[model samples]
Target chain A: MSSGEIKALVFDVFGTVVDWRTSISRQAAEFGAKHGVTADWDKFADDWRAGYGAGMAKVNSGEDEWKIVDQIHRERLEVILDEYGFPNINDDELTEFNKAWHRLDGWPDATTGLTRLKSKFIISSLSNGNIALLTNMAKYANLPWDAVLSAELAGKYKRHPRAYTKTAELLGLEYDEVMLVAAHNDDLRGAIKAGLKAALVTRPDEFGDAKKPDLEPDPDFNYFAKDFHDLADQLGCD
Target chain B: MSSGEIKALVFDVFGTVVDWRTSISRQAAEFGAKHGVTADWDKFADDWRAGYGAGMAKVNSGEDEWKIVDQIHRERLEVILDEYGFPNINDDELTEFNKAWHRLDGWPDATTGLTRLKSKFIISSLSNGNIALLTNMAKYANLPWDAVLSAELAGKYKRHPRAYTKTAELLGLEYDEVMLVAAHNDDLRGAIKAGLKAALVTRPDEFGDAKKPDLEPDPDFNYFAKDFHDLADQLGCD
Candidate 1:
């Protein structure tokens, strides 16, 4: 470890470690029920999540200033609140409900697999989500991360080379020594391009009935696993 | 939990969470034995740590460029190496030795108390140490941190208003909701000046007979306790 290398296993949070789609959908349904607004709650989750990409893209492109994922979610939440017949929700309620992202449910393998991997590697989050959101979700989902790192710290979102390499730098690791475990192929590709190792942990239910998931990894990826447990097994974690 | 507040108990790592002086002194004695040189290892720890303030103050005052705590420690280690009769140590060996700070031993109450605090509030590290240093130290010391935050993230060292306020902002909490727990009154005062709550957790043996410890808190501080366990009890964490 003297060559500025502290081996780390950084993770992508949203769909890989946590089942955001189902978690948000379930919460949205309950939120809708309380407000007496009954639309397709799953679609609402989708629409709200859709803003995330555009929000990050704008910031990355210099079209907008940097904002945390919580603000991004709130921006999207407000748009869909009116569109989805949730106009009566007060500002305070809206603020509380926006944290639904921070209360996501981790996939069953997430916590235990991460714990196992953490025994050997410096395990942390490398998500586009802000640190606050990731930290809160880690506690809420019991995803025992050694550190809660995020694109917020790097000031860049996923798929950006800076986002991938900066996270490795923060862990005092060479890019090659840091492995990114994610559900998205593009994120893995981004990691590879940034000189970090990549492992795709597929989540087929990530999109629910909304969109298809990325089940295949690119040839450049170092490993591919059905879930975090399989990844941990491949990584030789007990 | 709404209203931009996620209550957190952020900690000052060095003397508050870990017994750095004794740990560094003990490691330095072993280092000296290997190098065939001997001196007051405790004094060496003190001298090496003394450079920390000068390093951060230079950067803070814009007289020197930004550098991490690791680099600061490295600079200090190199100077003390010559004065303490270990001039033959190579750069690689020096680098490894500098990381002794990253492997400091946690206080008896550090781990258990943090685990208890984590049960109710988000518990993280709020140190002047860099993210890598704090993260690695957390691993070495078996300390549980929800997030590894630092003055490095804010590009300001502790005792700076930005360092205190920025950490709270990163956690998506108001100043008052994020309490800074430290073994030093100056740090607690810094947090209070930044509008965050403060708690003083004394480490009477912090300096290893080198200097006096800060056992008393300011009148404005929210709490004072003997150790993390006492702090935990006072904070109402089960």
Candidate 2:
């Protein structure tokens, strides 16, 4: 498909747009130094992220009450700090440190490609991150979004049909008119399942040697590209 | 109050940031000329807006089911068109005409002043208009909103206390830390009653001689400025 009918591009922000692993690892290293603690910051970033899926699953499965990603991150942070043998950090410092997620730096092509896309179509974040997280990150990273939408608005996490469909509904577009751009095959597949168009943008460095990444698009995906700039060019974004 | 604690400034878009009356009237004039019709487009704009309160009131009072501002505007447009003696316009034409609300022009201080305030505080649109309308308007008017929030998110209309509080909650802020910057006293008061701080930014020409503008802030308002630039100045934005 030419993607001519696509009116909005809703992005998966975490690994697709921002280099979260490097960003988080860098921030965590400074945070560790402040507390006189040392460990593998990269693993710390990964371990913190490991709790994200299970945390959302608990809410999606009705095992726990509804909570924002910030809350989930904070709860997981407490466990990670204890496991890493960190000293007693006060609540204020912990609260400030938790906002490291909001201060992420975008991938090299993110802001420029999004600016080009914005000239032609609406661009927004369709992430599991809550509204506050997305808004703060947009400012911190200079991702110019026309809207900051989240799965939090749908009361579901990514891969949930409602999350994809609800984002389309909120943007006042038909499901197919809002394309989901992500680095993960599963997420693109989920968007296709929800009747939305899907574009697979490869982020080979997303895992940074920690694990293999989804460099190939699924058969059902509408478009496949190496980065956002390639996706923007294929989509005819000037 | 120093206004130093305020983290985000949520705006009332229609009249505060944009001169909707002039924008609608101008668009209506162009539309009327194409249809071989002529009338006081300003009055036509006013007549069209008269349905807004009743439309939102029906939903807020649970008399009618929820509807987006686009639907409400279209419903109101049909009546005004018939009243103005326009010929039977086709569904496609009417649908296109209905988007006039999304094409509003911002007031002179809007873009530049908002850019200034955005440097120091998170700026957002917290309007009764639906997310689609706000998003479209932001792109058209060049309003720099960090988040396009709306009363629709709360499932309530303006003047509803829940609308104010829910906006603050979504921003991950306490009510007192998110100030509502509006030209209308009633909207500012609504935000105040919901435990938010209120800033009254006078828009003296908002009504365009149709009605008196609110040049004076309520005694309880935390700040009053002549325009967004003044508000930015008072708040110590560089």
Supply the global lDDT for candidate 1: 0.89
For residues A135-222, could you state the per-residue lDDT of candidate 2 as single tens digits?
A: 9999999999999999999999989899999998888888989999999999999999999999999889988889999988888889
> Residue B95 CA error for candidate 1 (Å)?
1.2
Which DockQ-derived CAPRI band holds candidate 1? high
Cα lDDT of model 1 by residue, B104-152, tens digit: 9999998898999898899989999998999999999899899999998
- For model 1, residues A1-238, the per-residue Cα lDDT tens digits are 4342438989999998999988999999999888888988788888899999999999999899999999999988888888876657777888889999999998988888899999999999999999889998988999888889999988988888999888888888788999899999888989899989999988999998779999988988988999978987887878
Native-to-model Cα distance after best TM-score fit, residue B195 in candidate 2, in Å: 0.9
CA lDDT scores, all candidates in order: 0.89, 0.93
**DockQ of each model against the real complex?**
0.88, 0.89
The CA lDDT at B55 in model 2 is 96
Clashes in model 2: which pairs? none
The true-versus-predicted C-alpha distance at residue A223 of model 2, in Å, is: 1.1
Per-residue lDDT of A196 in model 2: 94
TM-score of each: 0.97, 0.97
